[model samples]
Each structure stands twice: as C-alpha cells, then as structure tokens.
Target: MEILNEQVPAPADVGNALIGIRGGSELDLDLRLEAVHEGILVSGTATAQIAGECGRCLDSIEYDYEADIQELFYYEESEEFEDDDDVDQYWVIGDLIDIDPVLRSAVVTALPFQPVCREDCLGLCNECGINLNEDPEHHHEILDPRWAALAQLSDNVAEDAATNKTSDKREEK
Candidate 1:
C-alpha cells in the first residue's frame, strides 16, 4: 500500500461541451495505491478547475470540482478478465499505469449534463436574445395574430363612420 499526493497537469478534453477542465491546468491528486493479487488499485480524488458557459444564461461559469477516482489496472499477463470480453479493462504497461483515461472518465462523468451559472438563472429571451435576469419584467407586447385582422377591420369601420358624420353635419349647417 502507498499514498500518493501530487499536483499534475489536467489532460485535454476532460469535460463536455458546456464545461470542461482546460488542458495544462493544475490537478491536485490525493490517492492511495494498493497492490493486490489481480493488479494495482488506485483510489483517490482529483481536484480540478472547471470553466465553461452556462446552458441557460450563457454566462461564464467557473468553479473547482473534485472527482472521485477509483480504478483497477491489471497486470499485462494477468488472465483475470480474459473471459469478460464486454468488460472494459485497464492494463499496466511497462510497469507504468497511465491514469489519463481514468482521470478523464472520472471528471467527465461528474460534469453537469446541463451546466448552469446559477440555480435560478432567468436565461435569455427566446424572441430577442435579451438577458432576463437583468430585466425580470421585460417582455414584448405581441398582439395575437387572430385578433390583428379584427382590429384592422374595426379601425376601417370607425374611419368610415367619422367621414359620414362629418358630411351629415356639413349638410345640416
């Protein structure tokens, strides 16, 4: 058994479209490595800086995320998983265990499916791309299409009535 505490650079593409850890950023790793009959067990936590845009408001979202990492890397000559073709296995190569894939898996899975800047983000207006958070009461007064024709007809009728009333008053004078 061994304890490993170190800071390593984050691997590329450790996130989804909405959020991710930038490559070369610092990742603080605090883990334990154990040797067993099958292979080596690596369990720890990786802390990384997450940055991306919010899905709802498109605001920049930045935070620190700690992902739990636990994976088993089998020896190259080990036959423990030979029969399990469907099982994804990690192997020790040249006595070295590459934890990039493992770390990526841990971090990516923890990323939010739809990241948000805040819990109650109002988001942008669908009609005119305005941030509703800034103006909660902002809205466009859109007349219903069905009522628009009726409104136009009413205006025409009112204009004709006014014209007839003026002509009648002139003839009376």
Candidate 2:
C-alpha cells in the first residue's frame, strides 16, 4: 500500500506499475498505474463481502460484491476547481500516485441500499410479533374483529345473487 518510493523522478524507477492491495472487507484492491500524457491513470477492481441486517426481516445477511473503478488525476492546477472545500482531489503529487481513494470510492458506491437476506423472506408477523422465518408454524391470537367490512360485503353479494337467480327463473317461464 506504500507508493512513496515509486513516486519520484523518472530516475528513481521504483514501482510505477501494478500493485495488489489487501485490506478489510472494506475492500480488496488490484491497481495498475499508467503514466499517460495527462497524468497517471489508476485502474483497478475492488471486491469484498459485507454483513448487514435484512431490510424486511432484520436477519443477518452477507453479500459479496465487486466494483470496477477508474480515476483520472490531472496534473495541472487551475482556478476552475478549488481544493479548499475538497472539490479538487487528485492523486498527482510530484510523481507518486495513490489508488486508495479511488478504490474506496468505488467500494462505497457499489454497496447496496437496504440490504436483504433473501428476496422472499417473510418478515415478522404483525399479529403475534414473531419471526416468520424462524418458526413457520407460529400463529398469533385473533383478538380483534377480523371479519367486519369483508364479511358484510360477502353476505350482501350472496343475497343479491339469490334474488337475481329467482328473477331469472320467473323470466324464463
């Protein structure tokens, strides 16, 4: 992860090439540097597995993901972008370029929103307050009136159907 030595005058010729970076699941980085006309082009892929709570069931979930990132560090400094508020961020110092920031950016951007253990995970039961995944046979007590608007609607529909049937028979005769 140290590139201070590689970043020197051309005569230094230390390590301006590919380097492997291994860190926490924060990310595993593989980086390559190319001295282009503009500046050093850092290209690499970051991969890692993360553990998080499921959005629906609150269960622990683990996911492995990878993000490919490329960053351009222009050597020229101008008034177009200011570095006071962190707007100007470049890896070009004198000759040494760092890819940590680029890999971190890619890993952060690749993270998922609202992690989920499984797409079909059945969340806790609203009535019994139980994890549905853990106990499939769990049931909650039906205390309140579970049948009101729906029951009335069904009864009214049945009566109307009976009346329509009777009318139909009379008309047929």
Cand. 1 Cα-lDDT: 0.91
Residue 150 CA displacement from its true place in model 2, Å:
14
Note the Cα lDDT for every prediction shown. Answer: 0.91, 0.59
Q: Estimate each model's TM-score.
A: 0.86, 0.55
Poorest stretch of ten by lDDT in candidate 1: 79-88
Candidate 1, pairs of clashing residues: none
- Candidate 2 ranges with C-alpha deviation above 4 Å: 1-26, 76-89, 137-173
- Kindly report which residue stretches of model 1 are placed more than 4 angstroms away from their true locations once superposed: 144-147, 157-173
Error of 2 at 127 (Å): 4.8
User: What would you estimate as the lDDT of candidate 2?
Assistant: 0.59
Total backbone clashes of model 1? 0
Q: Model 1, 1-173: lDDT tens per residue?
A: 99999999988888888899988999999999999888999998989999999998899999999889889999988888656877668988887999988888888888899999999999998889999999999899888899999989999999999999999999999
lDDT score, residue 29, model 1? 94
In angstroms, the error of model 1 at 118 is: 1.1
